[model samples]
Target: MRHLISIAAFIATCAVLVWVFLPDPVPVETAPITRGDVTVRVEAEGEARVREVVVISAPITGLLQRVTLHPGDAVTAGQVLAQIGPVTPALLDSRARAVAESTAAAAAAAVELARSQLVQAEASLTFARAEADRTRALFERAALSQRMLDDAVLAERTAEATLASARANLAVREKELDSAKAMLNGDYAEDTACCIHVTSPVTGRILGVRTEDEQVLQAGTPIMEVGDLQDLEIMVSVLSREAVNIAEGAEATITGWGGPDLAARVERVEPGATTKISALGIEEQRVEVRLSLLAPAPPALGHGFRVTARITIDMAQNILRVPVSALFRSKGDWAVYSVEDGKAALQIVSLGRRNDEFAEVLDGLTEGATVIVHPADTVENGSAVEEKPLIGG
Candidate 1:
């Protein structure tokens, strides 16, 4: 019995020694390689804009009346938006006033000359008509030659044409005299009836008004902007490199504009690149990409609103994928520490595409295989490892 007790004590001592010398298993968080769809997307901030924005400008240089229409006001084609009237004449100096008076006098004299010419023409026409009638009567009776009768008719027609020309001259001279007199008298009264009405050329809501107060404006000055809210689209500026990958008609999603996620499609990617200063004070070449909302946008969505855009550049289905956190560079190649048989196995992986959360595993990984996520520096190949429970799981 004593000998048996000694042997048991020796065996227990040997077991304790082996247990003390053994290395502890390294705790690691792991996830199984998944076979699912992986989408590669590019994200950027964007703005909602009207696809077609129309600017209404002043048609003539004049005194612009106060605009009654406000932003967001519904407008119809040919609806009167504002009115413009002739500007009040400036106060003229003595010399200028005298010159204007002389011009008025000259215009009046021209009108009188035209009127006298008209009277003389009418009198001549009457005399020629009587002579032509007599000549025609003589020709009919074979008492006068056809040539003489033709001369009389020609004179009568010429006199009638001269009378008509004189009347036209008189009317033109009278208008010139009236214009000169108006300038001399400075008689531009402020009347809405005489104002030129500015009308909207489209049926839509007003986007913006340049000014609401009455002021003098030159012709072609923009007064307001109009656009259809229903035709809203998004404009996003992305890095030139990323822009090259985004194809026209690619699917996208929009968010962060005080609404639910909205579906959209890439309408176009601008060919030209623009230099932009980034928030970090870095100069970046960016290209503008246009996106069209697939569905009717919310009623609140309007021009110049902010939005977040995520454009899918590539996609793969039924492929092997793993969390991006598990990936790390090893010897200038993509690698991950995959857990196998309670040990960490280093894998040099061939990757295809990646996004914020996941990466496509082209090779060196299989579905249902567990990989250590965010492995520590101490982790290495063939190292003993144990799965760590997730917090709150």
Candidate 2:
């Protein structure tokens, strides 16, 4: 019995020594390499806007009547928008009145002279026509030459042209007389119906009323803004570095405008860069990227509405990829801890494109391979590892 007890004691002591010398396995989280579509996207806040914003302005300086139109009011072409009444003329002094009366008298004399000239022209044209007829008759009877007949016809044409000119001159003189008389009488008249009607030159909804109250305004003063909702588009500003990668016609996904996600496409990229201050107060060179909605926008989406745009700058399909958290820098190259047979093997990997969540694997990885995610500093090459179960798994 004493010899058996000594042998059992020696076996237990050897077992403890072996366990103390063995290395502990490092706990690690692992993820599988996937083969699927990988997309590189640039995201930024954007605003919806009308492509064409028209500002209605006053065409003349006058008393602007109160505008009855409001924002979102529908308007059509040639619709009367507002009325600008002519300002009341100042009462003329005695000398001014005298000058105006003299001008009116001169205009009246000019009208009389023009009317006499027009009557003379009419008589001349009638005589020319008679001569032309007589010359043609004489030429047919062989009493006149073809040249004489041509001369008479030319004379008649000239007389007709003169008659038309005299009639136009007489009409101009009559209008001048009327204008002079108006200038003299309007200064003294108490009541005159005179106003310019402002009309809408487009078909759209009023975006805003710039001058809604009655007041005096100068010509070219803005009255209101009009825009069509059907021409709504999106405008996005991105960092200049990212803008270089965005191409025209690239697809984008829009969200956060109180509606479902909508699809859009890049229409253009503005050539100029604008300076903008970021939330951190840093100055950034921002470039504008204009996008057109692929479908009609929701009714709630209108001008100046805020939205988020995720633009696809690059894409790769059916490619091997892994989570971005698995990648780390090593010796000036990208590296990852690839799991092989319960061991972490440090691998240098070639990558193509990367986004926030995943990266495209160009080489040094295969689909279905396991990689350590967010490896700790203690995890090194040739380290023994064990899969750490996720919480609640």
Local distance difference test scores for all models: 0.92, 0.91
Regions more than 4 Å wrong, model 1: 1-24, 93-184, 187-193, 389-393
- Candidate 2 has a TM-score of 0.67
Q: Number of the top candidate by lDDT? A: 1
lDDT of 1 at 103: 100
| Residues 1-393 of candidate 2: C-alpha lDDT, one tens digit per residue | 999999999999999998888788899988888888889999999899988998989999888999999999999989999999877778889999899999999999999999999999999999999999999999999999999999999999999999999999999999999999999998767646657899988898898899999998999999999888888999999999999999999999999888999999999999999999999999999999999999987777888899999999999888888889899999999999998898999989999989888899989998888889999998999998998733321
Candidate 1, residues 341-392, lDDT tens digits: the string is: 9999999999888888788998999888889998998899999999974342
Model 2 clash count equals 0
Best by TM-score: 1
Looking at candidate 2, what is the lDDT of residue 178? Answer: 98
Error of 2 at 350 (Å): 1.6
TM-score of each: 0.73, 0.67
